[model samples]
Target chain A: MKLKIWLSLATISVFFVGNTAFANEAEETVTPDEELYDTSILIEETELALTEEQMERALLLDEFANDRLSEIEATIEEGNIEEAEQLIEQYEEYLERLESELEESEEEQEASEEETNEEDNEVERVELPDSDDNDENEQGEDSDEENQEESAEDQDKSEEELRESAKQRTIILQALLEREDLPEQAKAGIAKALENQKRAEENYLRAKTEKAVSDEDEDEQEQEKEEEETELQEEREEEAAEQVEEENDNEAVVKAEQKQNKAEKKQQKAEEKAEKKQQKAAEKAEKAERKAEEKIEKAEEKANKAKEKAQEKQKKAEEKAQEEQEKAEEKNEKKQAKKAQENRQKEEKKNGKPNHQ
Target chain B: MKRAMMITCLFLLCACGQGEDATNDDNNSGQTEAVLYENDVFQIEEIDGWSVDQEATAEQEQNVIFSNGTTRLIVSIVSKEQTIDTLKKDVQSSFSKKVELIEDDENYIALLTNRKENIRGDVYFHQGSEHQLIFTFMTPEQHYQESKNQINAFNEGITIF
Candidate 1:
């Protein structure tokens, strides 16, 4: 029972793990917006291997060629031109054999690739989900009918994407191979790879151009995002400035209003004080006028009384002073006449400018 | 068998034709064991194909091998303050393949051999200035240790020009 339970647990665990693994695989296989390159092609079409005997022969031939070349070089150095030429011929012959063998190997690889491709196509047709299989078959049948229309649309899109990617890869490879530090042999290989890559890129571009134009949505989105961020930053800055302005405005308005209130109160107080001063001034003026009028009246009364008394006294004194006044007037007239004559004489004598005084 | 013998015979004949033929000529030729150049500032001569390039300073007498593809020059300079045994040991270690210490004492010194037999005469050490030269012949191993007086005399007689 324990064993059974353990087996059950193990099986359950495996099932869960397997499911998880399958989920991951499915996730990897099904990109939301991209087509996955199936590795099944490469797996089915394994690289062709050279036959052991052929490899050995090729190695031997290479060695032989190298030895012969060395011998030729030495012989030429030693002034054996004829011997060197013979060795050169042998080297060429061996090289030709090597070329043939290489060609054969390449052919074999092509054959293998074709066979694998066929097998892969067969498997692919059958390996899809039931719905996909039915759909694919239906698509195959309808491909004749609707392929032209569908392909025109699909091709344009695929081609553009493919071309863009190929261009990028070619540029990358070219950049890689162009490095100065790469070894001579590696540089040569890289050059060849670059050439092939360029060709592939060209083909991909050609195909892509034939298809629908690739959507610029991602690029647009990125640009939009950048623009949004910029706009948002600008908005934030505007908001910040507005907020600051508002705060300043609020502060200034409150302060201004408070100051205005203070000024109004001051003005009102000044007005009230002015009005009170005017009233007090009026009252003072009135009191002063009254006091003045009383004094004037009193003085006038006294004057009147005094005048009467003076008149009485003057009447008595005038009779006595009349003679003195006449005498004083005559004396004053004489003194004034003398003074005027003296002043005129002194001004005339002092200066012409003093004549005006 | 016959063909093998013929090839061997041909090889031997070629070798024999190339062997040194100066055994008696060296003795009769009024040749100094060591020839000096530049008024005796430098000296160089072959001993059993072992070439010596010798130079001298105020403090020591230096012997060198002018053999070896390498530009390296090995100098064995002797000073009055140093011992012959030490000098000999030094020379032996330095010129293990090309030179050997034949005789060494307070009053006399000699070096035997100067070149490696199997390494082809491609590599050697030699000493000379543009103005001076000194040459000393390499002594055979068998006679080097035996002829001490003769070796010393040879070394002592070594002069420039």
Candidate 2:
């Protein structure tokens, strides 16, 4: 009874002490991330955990194999070459099996991915989108001969209009996307179709701009010719006005002053023409600036898409490399374990305990 | 009260005497059987008056006698290296028992006490060296010299592979 009482007291004290020790240990080891990060970090952490466990297993196997190899070395030193050779053969066979298993799994993954790709491509496509619906509808029902002629004319008009619009849109969009003043967020929102449209707008705008510039130059040349013609006509009119003034001078001096006023009117007209031309040039520059801004935005969106794709590719490559490393480690571990077991047996035999079945 | 004390004293003496008698019987039987080392190193038989202290280091055993008829054979294998004198000193310090040094050569050799009460033999093989053997024996002082002939017979009897 006394001994049992003492034993119970001892057990209670031991339990109390153990609990206190465990609580103290737990208090001392508070990890920072556990307190800070969310559950996704934990999930990401779980991915690493699997590889770590595999690596740890591999390490154990490596140690075991190394120990076995050392024992084999010892045996060789003891002139037991036959036994050592047999151990080496066993180790090699185990490693080969491990390597083959790794290769087989990798092949299986590749085959499955190939099947998925094939299935995706095998999806049957149906009809394409309507490209000429508006034109077809406009050439309505009538006598077949009239309708066919009208239809052809409408088709030709629609084709020309589409071609012209496509070129104009590509130029405008490209110019807008290329503009430096555009914000980054604005650039990201442009879609692939919008990009294609912008390209067409930019081309059309460039052609239109070139045509307008050439037309303006032609108009300037025509104006110069008209100015020369008008100058000659003015000379004639001035001469006639002077002649009229001379004829009127016999009647009255006030009539002679009207001839001098005609020259001042011509000068006022020339100043007005110059002011109007300056205003037109300023407006054209503004429109070009807007187009340039849109083009800049489009280019930014394209760059962002490219960057995202490259990042995704890099992430996938990293995942593949990690998987390969894990597989290799697992193979190594299996090999190591086999070696360790053989080594352990050899050690036991040398120690004369012969721990075999 | 006096009678109770007397009875308790008598009971204690009887208990001790019976324990001694049982121990002696165990010792005699153990001496006749061969001593087997854990590593299958060596075995010796027919020693006289053997006793074993089982509470030793996990890897080793100490102080057991082998018997051949009336003679006692004591055997020990030491697997560490030190001078014979140093080993003798360490054993004496650790075990607190004097070892009679008989043939103290490069490897270990020590004989047992030859008196009738001290008829115990001892063998010390330096398991320190890769290959070294030592064997020692003791008998009733009358048979002390005669025990060498019996000890030599062990070499002839042992078959090493």
Candidate 3:
């Protein structure tokens, strides 16, 4: 019996635990009306704060503004005019912020574009020092074209998106304003919100129109600049071509002059060589003639010497012959005298003694 | 029989505790804490009255920003090798020149005032093993002290992966 009582107590405890769990679960479920709108706004603000790009932020703001409008409509449908009025005020504030943001974004974009232009100009100045102005201008035009294409594509896409969103919001607001069952208290707030929306739309349209005009003006300016650049380029090309032609002509003249000078120098050298050859030949001939004359003179002198020697030999032989003849005659006369003296006997002895003496 | 009575009383006490917990949960119904962001390097959650800035988070690869009214909490994970000295230097350099070192410990904390902007920031540096986590809480100078709890709560919600 005690065990049975224990089991019954345990059962009762389990039932109490189960009941508590169910109660907690029921309390956890929350309805949309009970949802914290303030948190939603905080979330929206947080999202906006986090967005770094202006166009993206504008788009987010547009989305949030639409959310507010939907909330206002829901509140109005629920007969909560006070809440609807509050949302309408919030909506107006959102619209104001959106407008300011869009304006700020546009200004920032313009400022950034100006900064890019300045930077490009600086780059052109820095990079193209020795280059021709035409080349520099062409480079600048190329960079400008690239930047414009990129900026135009992005700006056009974003602007188109914003314009579409604005139009959609305007239509939604108008439809809401046209609701027949809207409470009198909510009607004024909605009308005021609608007016604010229209004003924002008008501002957007005006800005877009101005942007279009400005773009047209920029296109015209770019076209004119391009034309000027092309003309300058053409003139520069013509000048370069002319300079090349002149350089070629001057080079040809210099080459011809050089050729003539070379030919003259070659002819002069050949003439000098011919003159030297003639002078050498003349000198050789004169030396041969002088050698021949000296040989002739030497031969004549040799012949004269030979003749004089022969004459001297002949004279010497004659002188010798005369001496022999004289000697013979003397001998004969001495012999005859000796004979005659012998004939005279004693007179021959005396003649012989005189002869010995 | 006494044991059974004691067991029943214990169960009754547990039930009451659960009911009280449920009441507390009801009180904090819409203000539930949730994981606001997660990545390969870290995870962070939304604190009470603070919401995550999705755009700012998406803009930077490893950075997140949480905002509440005029106060903002910026959390960034730097995938760089860092020591205490470098972390201190980073903290000092990350803020304005007028930033003062308020607390120096394992985590470096700094207080910076931008007089021109009328803003004040309480910056904290947490050095991890392979990465450094920087948390910057900024608000108007007037509300700097009032936003301390939010800053602390945000700090508590950060988890480095």
Candidate 4:
């Protein structure tokens, strides 16, 4: 048994020691100056090829650009100006790729928006004559509008994030340029990169301004079109009213008076129907409120009943415990009395025996 | 019985200690090998001390890198269109002017030395029917000879289809 316990402890200690060593090995990292650094670059290139999305690719390119910047700084610190220059060139290439990718993504988003607008226009053209179908169409339009709003918000958020990243890059580059120990060759590269970053930022602002202008123009055009449509509708209504007046002029006075009275009766009937509908809706609301109140009351009553049952159970348990305690006390008292009686008998026997002696 | 138990405990502890020492020796000498990467083209194993550079492998499926301390072994599988002459040109263009073609035949091996970086590389190219495999083992110039056995062990684990 002791041997088994010792073996188990030895095994456990060995296991823990092995695991700690493995963990330490796993936690080790390779830095840029190491021989495996080129491997790291190869892996990064492979990942870049596999990434499919434009915005994600652009973000990744930005990350790689930052990595190159750090590598350049490290190389410069080690007095390896040639490698720093090479890293700077690579950084420039990454920046160029990132700019192109951002542009492509923005253009794609705009194209998709245009396509959605065209689709909405087509849907609007296919209007149904039935009023119920028109209501459904209106709801569909509302959902489409909501989707457009969400997409617009997403686009704004992405653009803002990109701008923020660009700003950050600029700040880093500016700081690097200001460093007193920076080599002349590296300083030139950083200055050029900083300029490129500023240009990219300006391009983003330009695109945003252009989009805003275009949206304003579209809104203005839509408003003008709506005003024109309303004007035409008013003109058509005026024409119909003139025709009705001419018909009245041609018809007898009594007939026209009868037509007017029939129209007034129809309006009154429509008003009565509307009032009844409102009253029915109000009654339904009241019924719902009463039903909710009854449900709450029922739930409360059930809770009270459960509480009462639990209290009664607790009381019964308490009474049973008290009875058990009292029984134990009575038993203890009887045992003590029996012991005292036996002692008294012994004492009497002793006295009688001594007297006989 | 108590003395026997104490003796058994000491024996167990000594055995465990020896086992640990053996494992450490194996890790240092690159004696143990395990399959580190595999695909349709080929399968390769890494030496005991070496670890796969996961960040690199995660990015590209065509290539994998194993590193042991400052030593690195990079394995890449490319198209068979890469000829020995093209491989030579690639080596010449990438490496320093001091790089030498030490071996030439069915397998082209180049020794690359970069004085500035104080690193040396032994690059090997193997062409199979469907794919061409390139292995580049790099280490500090001072330790290049010491890493030869590890490199050889790593190469022996490669089985190409």
Candidate 5:
């Protein structure tokens, strides 16, 4: 009886949670991509994604931006031509701000993506020395770093999504602007929308140039990591050689040590040669494969060209045949008509009807 | 090897020879076509199988009308006395709602109109320093497909010297 009561409680709680999920989804009036011009969800997502400073610039790009352009067009449609110029200029600033925001976000994303890419590079090059225990320890440490890095990557993905949303909005605005059959009054609004997009693009390029100067820091970090790895390996080699040197107490021992060092150097040279040969072989195979692919593509292109030429020739031949047949048919009809006219003339003469008539 | 090459050349020549014959036939078809009308005043060079109306009694009639059976070309000289807007308004009213203003500007305004009885006319209004000219070419819908190129050529051939 107690078990049954516990089961009933669990079932009731599950039903309540399911109902809550459905109710939450039903609250949204429009889903993404339902309407190209509708920006409800995208605006909400963007507002969430942007920081406090960025939010200020993003305000100009609100869904209410369409209202100002619509108002300008309404004024123009009312035949207020003189005020239209001033209205267009006033609306241009808001569009400029929105465009700059788009650009700023894009530039910031590019800079942040470069930094993440460098970190990924450093993580990739973190291969431990030839020791299993060291490798295992380093692997565990790398996994933890990777988990932390994943959150940073998640931030980048969100930034990318925001940029994509901005691009979609810009494209939709431009498409609405390109309607030629639209009235001149309505054109003012479309033009303003386009102007905003253009201003955004320009602002992005300007900002990208300034941000590009800072991208050198990520490159320097990558170089520093490579230097650190090389220094660490050199230190390990020196420590091993020092241990061997400390044991050299007599002449025979020193000579044995020198011989051992010479043998080791010879093995290292042979290993380097083997590695070079293997790399060259791989390169040669890749080159030959590429050449073979190119040759096949060239053969296919030649065959296609020849086929097209032959088809064109055949088409021309058929057209000529058709025209010749038409000409023969026309000539035959003309001859038959002439002959029938002669027969009618003979009959008319026999009946004594005047040929002149 | 030489014999094989000769055979291949012959085969290709035969394939393309039909095109040459068609081209020759096309040239012959046009060679038989003779000119019928040439006008200097309304700045027309030549027209095939068409003649200017030489029987109009009214001297004040500012129109030079060309005819080939049912098809007609009527050129009205405006003398820059009226604005292009007036001409636009006049055509709009004459053709009513279905008149499409294809090209509209200060120097040139062209209108295409489809009227009752399957008749369609292409009207061009050209502006010059001394005079404005309106040319209306009217044809039936059946004849339009064949005569469109001829009409375009006639319009292009007119020089206002």
Candidate 6:
């Protein structure tokens, strides 16, 4: 009863703490644009994740990724977006298969654990009176303890593997999120997957904590402890699921508010843009009007200057004509005078004597 | 008279030396004098009876080919971005045939093979500080012997800038 009470208290405390931790963990990155920037990053991470494959399988996967990338490029070149999308889906399926393989191996390990536990229970139930076979019984107990220790180590190792597997899933999720063109349902699907991983991480941590407690309290009835722990874990899982549902509701409400805020911001930005455009248009029209008035003023001034230039040219032409007439008159007068002198000379020659001018 | 005689002797000496030089050039005509061919990357001396086909140098991987009808030299200017081993793998895959490495040094590797009955391929790979150059020489089996000597001359004349 005391153990049950302590376990209950631990469960309650874990609930509150786990809720906060998971809520934080499950917090979705709000900026969709930032998610788009992660595509290349996720691809690089996929490459890094590939380094763990030190075998032929890893090489094959590397080759497969390269080949798929080539195929997708070719499909895109042919302008078949649908086919390219399908190819991407097929390639992602291969990645998902790795995750699923990990899950399946974990399940097989759990099954083996259950089998060992049942065998241990059977060994416990086998009633053998105190007899000469006590040595055999001790050996059996020793072997059982060894088995338990081995299973515990295996569980610890699998914990690390599980963490690794979850990390890989998270990487894939990041890649999925990076695809800005995915449908809303697809985004929701990724969200659900993230929630699942969070829950898995929580359970894993709880299991670790409980294992420590069990180790410390090993003097207690081990079988009853196991049964109680299982029940308590189940109960906690139920509570966690409900808590997740409630958190989802709260998240939705928060998202809706965020959406409304975004919409308001967008509308205000649009209004500001329109007002600025209108103001710019008014300024442009005013500038154009000023330019046109200036151009007309310049043209009119040019025309007036041209008229003045033409009048001056006409006056200059008249003056030139007058100068020519004056010169011609002087030449005519000179010719008449010369002709008169010649006439006088001719008269003298005809008389064959000097004549008075 | 003495000056005239000395001038005549000098003229005779000059004529005899010129005749001998001309005859020697004719006798050694088979040596095939080479001329330096260079562009932005590296310089190679192209030998006599060989010329680059400008039209066939349009491929992205290889930009130049020097040919003498029966024999050809393909030049690929690989950038310094890749390691030497990667360059070899690329060459092997590009040819789609196993190439035997005949010369391996810190700066270069020479790969050769007789791909066909009467045709041979020789690849001279040079790892440079700024560029990796690959020279693929293909020639008929009969000309392969002479082609090797010519290739060596070309290699010796090559100076990567």
Identify the leading candidate in terms of TM-score.
Answer: 4
Candidate 5 lDDT over A1-357, as tens digits, reads: 999999999999999999999875333223121221122222222222222334333542543244344444555556665555555564565566665665565656567676756876685567556756777766776886686588557545544554565565555544444434445665666555555554454444444444443444446546657866786697578768866866664566776677789669868866886696578656755665565556556645754564466567658868888999999999999999999999989999899896775
Q: After superposition, how far is residue A330 of candidate 1 from its true place, in Å?
A: 99
* DockQ score of the complex predicted as candidate 4: 0.02
C-alpha RMSD of each candidate structure in angstroms: 52.8, 44.6, 56.1, 29.8, 35.4, 36.5
Tens-digit lDDT track of model 6 for A1-357? 999999999999999999999875323211112212122222222233323222212222433443444454445556556655665665555444444444454456556667876876786677476767768877987987897788658656645654665565555555554444555654555545445544444444444444444443343347446766786697588657756876767677776676578669758866886696578656755665565556556645754564466557657868888999999999999999999999889989998988763
DockQ of each: 0.01, 0.00, 0.02, 0.02, 0.00, 0.01
Q: What's the true lDDT of residue A272 in model 4?
A: 82
Between candidates 4 and 5, the one scoring higher on TM-score is: 4
Per-residue lDDT tens digits for candidate 3, residues A235-347, read 58865775687676767777667657866975886688669657865675566556555655664575456446545765786888889999999999999999886667666
| Evaluation by lDDT, superior candidate among 2 and 6 | 6
lDDT score for residue B104 of model 4: 60
Task: Give interface RMSD (Å), model 5.
Answer: 27.7
DockQ, 0 to 1 scale, candidate 1: 0.01
Q: Which regions in candidate 5 have their CA more than 4 angstroms from the true location? A: A1-51, A55-91, A99-196, A202-227, A249-357, B1-161
Off by over 4 Å in 6: A1-357, B1-36, B58-62, B98-119, B127-129
Question: Judged by lDDT against the true structure, how good is candidate 5?
Answer: 0.57
For each candidate, how many residue pairs have backbone atoms clashing (under 3 Å)?
33, 41, 1, 1, 1, 0
**Candidate 3 residue A195 C-alpha distance from true site, Å:** 1.9
Q: Candidate 5's error at A187, in angstroms?
A: 4.3
A1-357, model 4: which lDDT tens digit per residue?
999999999999999999999876433322355534554566445345434567756766776776677677667878888888888888889999999998898788888878987887888787766757888888888998898898678667766766787777776776677665777888889888877776666566556655665665577557757866786697588658856876867666766676688669758866886696578656755665565556556645754564465557658868888999999999999998999877777887887753332
Model 5 residue B86 lDDT?
A: 61
* CAPRI level of candidate 1: incorrect
B1-161, model 6: which lDDT tens digit per residue? 99999999999999999999999998677334444467777776666666776665543233566776566676777767767665554443232122366666654555453232233556667766777787766665566777777777667867776
* Model 6 residue B66 lDDT score: 73
